[model samples]
Target: MVRERKFSDEDLFLATKELLLDYGYEGFTFGLLAERLGVSRSALYKYFGNKEELIMEFMMYELDQFMDKLRKINDYNRFEDQFDYLLELLMNHPQIHQLIEIGRHVPVNNQKLKEKNDKLDGLHLDMYQSLVGFVQQGKGEGKLKPHIPDTLIVGYILQSFLVPNFAQIPHSEWVQSIKEIIRNGMFTDDH
Candidate 1:
């Protein structure tokens, strides 16, 4: 009979995110993960063959979490409400962007890792589909300007987190300011 794992996948994934963020992909190792999970390296081996498999699994968890929350944007009927919800959601996932970028660099030497990487790519497209739909909805409702390309709008909204917070503005205000700029141009109606 197989023995059960002492730690839950949720616990392991949480620790994985923390450790990966603290120490980059090259620096991350099973020894470090074992220490974080308070388990022996051999214990982890029972779950994954190597660090790559574990990291792929962890990325899957992250995508599932992000996609779950992203699906909720449909709950809000109004474009403004959807916009607000998305902004707030994006704010909460500040590190996710970086995490996803890291996932992109993970090498896929074997079939399993390749499959996981392909799934990750599919999920990314699904995310873009939702975001594009959101933009299209706004355009259809006259909430967003029709002249501007949907790709540009979607790209801006998606990359908003990349803007450096060098000014040290409060999070709420910063997000609000970004919303205003997206809704209305910097020059205002007068210009």
Candidate 2:
């Protein structure tokens, strides 16, 4: 009789995400993943053909989790509350943007990789729609200025995640300051 697998797909995906973030794509290896999961390298190959397949699957998994949280923003009655929730979501998953950047360079040498890239593109469209809807709602509710374009608002929100902290500010303070800057312009009322 065949033995049952010890770890679930979730277990593998979570471990892969951590390793990818720490080691990046160039450094990531099946050996490291197998060692981290307490499984043999061949055992991993049974699930994924190679690192690219594993990484693609992992990205899909992470995107699903992210989409779940993003959908919850609609439950809030106030745009301000939704905006705060959105900030928390983005800040909590700072590596998402990095993962996306990594995905850009992910070689598509097979049909499976092409399909995965197409699916990822669909997820990106869904995310963009959700963000646009949120911005539109904020504008209608007067929480966001009418003159500011939705694309600009969304871009600013996304770019905020990449802002450098050269001053070594505390995470809490940095987040709070970012929230303030996003909500209120940098210039004082006197200006």
RMSD of 1: 2.7
Clashes of each: 0, 0
What residue pairs are clashing in model 2? Answer: none
Question: How well does candidate 2 score on lDDT at residue 114?
Answer: 91
* Clash pairs (backbone) in predicted model 1: none
- Candidate 1 similarity to native, TM-score: 0.83
Q: What is candidate 1's local distance difference test score?
A: 0.87
Please provide, for model 2 over 1-191, each residue's C-alpha lDDT reduced to its tens digit, 9 standing for 90 to 100: 98888899989988988888788888888999899889999999888888788888888888888988888999998998999999999999877777777766678789999999899878878888999999999999988999988999998898888887898999999999899899887777786
Model 1: CA > 4 A from native: 1-6, 164-168, 185-190
Q: After superposition, how far is residue 86 of candidate 2 from its true place, in Å?
A: 1.0
Q: What is the Å distance of residue 22 in model 1 from its true position?
A: 3.5
User: Model 1, 1-191: lDDT tens per residue?
Assistant: 98876899889999999888888888888899899888998899888888888998899889889999999999999998999999889888867777887887789999988898899888888888999999999998888998989888877886778788998999888888887877775776865
What are the per-model C-alpha RMSD values against the true structure?
Answer: 2.7, 2.4
Query: What is the TM-score of each predicted model, taking all chains together?
Result: 0.83, 0.84
